[model samples]
Target: MELRTRVVLQLAMATGAAASTLQMRWTTDAGACSSNGGQCNSLGPDGPWQAVMVTAGLENADSNSAAEVVDMPMWPAVGSISGVLTTSSGGEYNPFMSVSANKTGVRHDAFGPWLANLFINMTDEGPGYQEILRFKTSTDNSDELNATIVAAETWDIRMPTGAKYEAPAGFLGLGPSTAEDNKSIPPGLLDQLKAAGTITSNSFGLHMGSVALGQKGSLILGGYEQNRALGDVGVFELVNEVTRAFIVDLTLSVETGSSPFNQTGSMWKGVEGSEYGPDVTKNIGGVSGSAAILPSAVTPYIYLPPGNCEAVAEQLPVTFRQDLGLYTWNTEDPAYARIVNSPAYMGFVLADRTAQNITIKIPFKLLNLTLESPLVAEPTPYFPCKSVDSAYGVWQLGRAFLQGAFLGFNFEKSVMYMAQAPGPDMDQGVTRTLEVDDEVILSNAADTFEKTWRSQWTVLGGDETGSGEGGAETPNGSAPPAVGNDGQNAPGNKIGEAESANGDGETEENLGQVQEQGSLSVGAIAGVVVGVVAVLGLVASGLLFWRRRRRQAAKEDVPEKEWEAESASGVHFPGLGIKYEMYAPRVTHEAPGVELRHEMDGTGIGRRSMRISQDMYANRI
Candidate 1:
């Protein structure tokens, strides 16, 4: 038996120079100009006249894209600190750096995409959480991050049409409290270990000796109070007026750079909520959450393992382990992270924990967009264009990547000690580390991201290195990434539970990564097998029925006995509403697992047909 299936791809490809029903191809220019077939760049330096296109079945980023989180980059270090502490070993203290919290803005999402990019570019992925940052569990050290506050790409702020109402592009900014000064680090931790010791690792790019007390944690410089939706923080960056209204998607890597721990496992992608901030809750006591973060700035974290059994990881949403005297995940387990360092702070500290290997690589990438249409819904009349379906075949696209991520960290150098407050006012004590380097290559993140994805894509292609999706040059089936059901964040940052799809078991489409939260086990992958759908069979049946009817109408009826006794053995219809009901049961094998609905009208019709067929049976079984 021959079986047929229909797979819709990018719509941009359908209207292009190379249009194949199954293949969708779009250009960046088209993405910028049109909502349905393109993507956009949050960072500037983008040219005017750019165009990104989307082939048929391929939804445009403007149409399917969601606002994503990018890494925060430091514009420039305003000040620095150094101290000398004596150790019991009779050595000068290792040099740990610190900066005061004189943070500027905490609510900066109103600025357009350009300014938004600026803010994210300034921040880097910090140290791990206490929960998953263990030095060793059972076998070896592993670098795992417990994403305390689930970060998702959401577009909450909107453009204000008038006064009194906030702009729609508002950002949910939050930060940590305290000074960036480290007072008790053992003098020369890196110098002593490397100058004379038995260890292995490297220094870091961005440097802070301690994690909690000395690192930047969205805290404004010098203790100035910054208004945050939830915790302490200055807004991401400076945004322009136009940017306040436009929507853009940014994908963030959870733990950037390399690893300090030594483990051998992998990580996977999880679904993200598609909204900005969550529903406002008032008056809570038991089990209420603290230290909130902007959903839009959420990203994926890398996973690592521990060899020994003496270290632990911290899991703060906006703060890092370095701020609290803990090690980072990049120095020990790097996977192609670039080694960048500020001359003021030397990197690579595997041998002796001097400065860490500033190889903590964080990446932010932009995809398919056109100039005239940077966003899907914009300044003028909404273009009435033929659109793609709501479903974004992300799994089909995801099949081309490494499929997992790994995080790394150094446990020996970074340690944590919890403390209670003075007079029960409650002093939260955590000290960790985050390194800083002065290598500003905006494109580095994009390059590394593309490289990793390409590597996996190459493997997926089975040794054929043509270079598929998410690469420097356009990918093999280059089209826009998935967008939201409508290019907007989920209602109030709420995540909808998994439910059944359409008759074919499909949920709505075009939902960008923002709405992609859900656990998919590796075990589940082995269980799914391709199956034929009754819808297609019914389509064929309808066409055949139409042809037969047309032929019958065109010619006179044959002799009475000439018409073959109609097959009462099986009942099938190809007309209108009756089509699905008749063919569904005939083509389905997994009905037991499906939600069954009885159509009374259909039952009545069937009873009527059965009565008519009984008359025709006339003595035949």
Candidate 2:
């Protein structure tokens, strides 16, 4: 049957008002990590991902809890979770870098301290102490499951002895396996969780909160949070590509007042021989759809082609701060007051195959971001908006895109569900509708619909005895779980709360309810305390990273008079080591001109620190 038709039928067959959904409340480090005399001071506007504390060691080696789990602020992306290991001999191994099967161990050194930790203690078989890399994966305060790791190495750094290690176990790899530009095979973390019955379905949800608003993001493993979603959910097909990234096509535009700043051309182009990129290669306007990857982990920004970047800047009444490589609005200008008062009135737009085009309102308060690092003596508040040249072949829709929308990933269906997030300026009347194919409907009618629905759950290992009141009745009671505004448990023992618990063998009857730390086990309390302390360090380290970037920005800051003189020079970010050259190409039928290139490369369903050592990468982040 067609996918939409099946979905409609499932909605009908599933007779539950109470959703059997798993929900995790998103929190921020701003409470504890603020350096402005304990006041609110966040580096980015939004960067909420699932994190947890974990221990790592070899599979067979004796484990040691004292193996220093250093509080190096490490927040892996929700979409991509892996580890960077430094062997005892100063070797670095990154399993996520493995694109081909035969690539057992390659050394990659493009990462900055922003991505690396100071060190990790080992039990002789750990990343820093052992000759090879391996880690035992388990989160802090909990031991629901333990998994082994197959070691993978970087291309630039090799083992001291030049001896090869075993191939990587390869779990939770969002990228395509084999790196031959093909689709991913089964056996991902989602598949494993489903197979183990940790979750009922292969669907997951994400809600990244605005950092400025003191909101936290959430990651739901089995189902989505209905309350968190402000508007109607829009489902879109994933680009049929071999890579596992969430690739999609979107048209770009902006609105300052009436007469919108409608751009024409592609925002991002796909690689040749790949099912990504713009429809027409060159002289692209923002109006045309362009293929781009929505990156969940990084900071907010729309990485666009040089031509498009120039167009956006020209239209917006903002200044280009060379030192920060950001666009800035004059605080003294009247427009700035309007921007601050009605930030929602000034926003961006993205169009895709779906009828409802996505629009996100960026508040002026969020734009006033400060770049403070250990390298910088003080904080520099440059508007965070930036337009990068997409020459580096990395066409990305970063956090900026997500701020306006809520995205869900269905690994089972290989599709991404998107919907405009609720906002102050959103058009309340805007909506999208889809009608199931008539042929499928007629065919479905031919069969016993009720019997078919009953049998479907039966095949899914449901109890099939009864459907309950206040929700759909099912044999197994696997109805969709309801989400509360507080983001706590559903009505009853709804999710994996019955199964997962602390090492003490206690299950939380109130799955959505989180009590005070005093009520939790010693391990849970310790995890919370450790997280608070480490987050402070993370904020401190982030400031240091910003300082380092400031130094680089100072060295390359160019004036308008010197623009022609320095046009040929590339702007290099010290800490990140990425070199960007600004270039604007005229509209053309060929490929869009290039601007920024990425030199360095960088889930999920939780909030904790996970140890992968050098041997194993955490399967779930």
**Which run of 10 residues does model 1 get worst, by summed lDDT?**
393-402
The true-versus-predicted C-alpha distance at residue 73 of model 2, in Å, is: 6.0
Q: Which model scores highest in lDDT?
A: 2
Report clashes for each candidate as comma-separated counts: 199, 67
- Judged by whole-model lDDT over C-alpha atoms, candidate 1 comes out at 0.18
Deviation in angstroms for 124 in model 1? 25
All models: lDDT?
0.18, 0.33
Candidate RMSDs in Å, in order, are 32.3, 28.8
User: Which numbered prediction scores highest in TM-score against the true structure?
Assistant: 2
lDDT of 1 by residue, 1-621 (tens): 111101212232332111100111112222221222223322211111111111111122563453221111111111111111112111111111111112122222222211222112112111211111111111112222221110112222111121111111111111111132633222222222222321222111111111111111121111111111111111111111100011011111223232211121211111121111111100111011110111121111111111100111111001112111112222221110111110010010010112111121121111111111222223211101000010110000000000111111212222110000011011222212222221111111222333332321212222211122332111112222222344222233333222222344342241222245544444443332111234346667889998898688658755533322332222332222232222211111111111111111111112233333233122221
- The runs of at least 3 residues in candidate 1 whose Cα sits more than 4 Å from the true structure, single-residue gaps closed, are 1-235, 238-456, 459-621
Per-residue alpha-carbon lDDT of model 2 for 146-175, expressed as tens digits?
222223233121111232232111112222
Off by over 4 Å in 2: 1-65, 68-81, 84-186, 239-293, 315-317, 332-334, 345-348, 351-356, 360-365, 374-376, 392-394, 423-621
